[model samples]
Target: MNRLAYHQGIHKFFMMLGLALHISKPVWKHLVHLVDALTTKRFSGTLTDVHHWSFHPNHRTTLSHFFTKSPWNEERLLEKLQEWVLRQIERLAKRTNQPLFLSIDDTICQKTKPSSRATHVIQGCDWHYSHKDHQMVWGHSLIWLMVHTFTQAFPFAFRLYDKKAETSKMDLAIEMLSSLKGKRARPVYVLMDSWYPSRNSSKPA
Candidate 1:
């Protein structure tokens, strides 16, 4: 779950793809270092770690640009990530009898800064009441689709829920399910907490 394990293989995947897509080597290096810092428990989210233990040298300002204004198709990148996830799940399925689980859930990641307010309009960040915190919080409400094969879970897709967009959390889950139809994974049991399950949870009969 930390940088060491992921950097061994996943970083290589990103590097090769970045090269094929004509991404600058620096961008590719930052991509790996960004993920490394984010997943690391030691220096998590600190700018110093992203210079990557002095492995790659760059200013902290670069990360802000990499996250917000990077000229890449996020949706396409996510699709490729999902493809890799599915392939791994399929490989794991061959070794286990456990049924594949497709789970849907969401959370509010509250933003606490004025500059971070950019997410307010652009990335679906807003005030949403949180049962966990017992009050409204300013942040993005993001829902995810993940696949599990008994031993592990892999994130497949995501949707940012904007109240102004009029899409309910349940609706976002259903959209992911619909979009996944005709894919290779089958016999996927839908998993959810009490808040999400309903007679309408599944597609129309």
Candidate 2:
């Protein structure tokens, strides 16, 4: 199915759930349209279907503008979304005997243009011969904590680390571990590469 149809279907499904009655149906639909446009690869467009709902032709709407106009506060929305996701996960976990596995890893995405938002990010030391270019390039790595159960994988946390940063990947791992310490479904094991060895690391595997 096309992205627009898929997104429209999802919005309809969520509306049927009746979580909160305070939000207007039109507004909720617009929010869903905006979110799908921003996050999904298949739904790429500068102007969203939201433009169709607006009467003024000259006005253009962006994701940032949608958020600003949204009645639901960002923090509360995030918290509620997280709670719903966790509930769904717990339901699935109860159906299986296997324990959840958490994996931590970092990756670098090389960018040609520098970002004003990239200040204080550390530069990378030459770890290996560059495959993309002959010369070494400054790279920033981001650490992510992901959980795997029998049927699904959930990403719980992410942190960015530069080579010149004071904190190490180990530090980021520790932070991720600390964050998950008291979860209802405690992870059975944490998997990591040789860069994070079991012998020397303070975090449990």
Each candidate structure's count of clashing pairs:
0, 0
| Candidate 2 positional error at 3, Å | 7.4
Candidate 1 TM-score versus the reference: 0.74
TM-score of 2: 0.57
lDDT of 2 by residue, 66-149 (tens): 556656655444445545556666667777766767789876555444556866543452232244566555554577888677
Worst 10 residues of 2 by lDDT: 49-58
lDDT of 2 at 197: 57
Per-residue accuracy of model 1 over 1-205 as CA lDDT, tens digit each = 2446566665678754444375556566677776666665676556767666524457778877887787756676666677677778877876686678888888777776346445445355678778798888778888888888889998888888877765678888889887675656446788886657676543210
**Runs in model 2 lying further than 4 Å from the true structure:** 1-31, 42-61, 64-78, 113-140, 181-187, 197-205
- The TM-score values for the models, in the order shown, are 0.74, 0.57
RMSD of each predicted structure: 5.2, 6.8
User: Model 1: which ten-residue window has the lowest total lDDT?
Assistant: 196-205
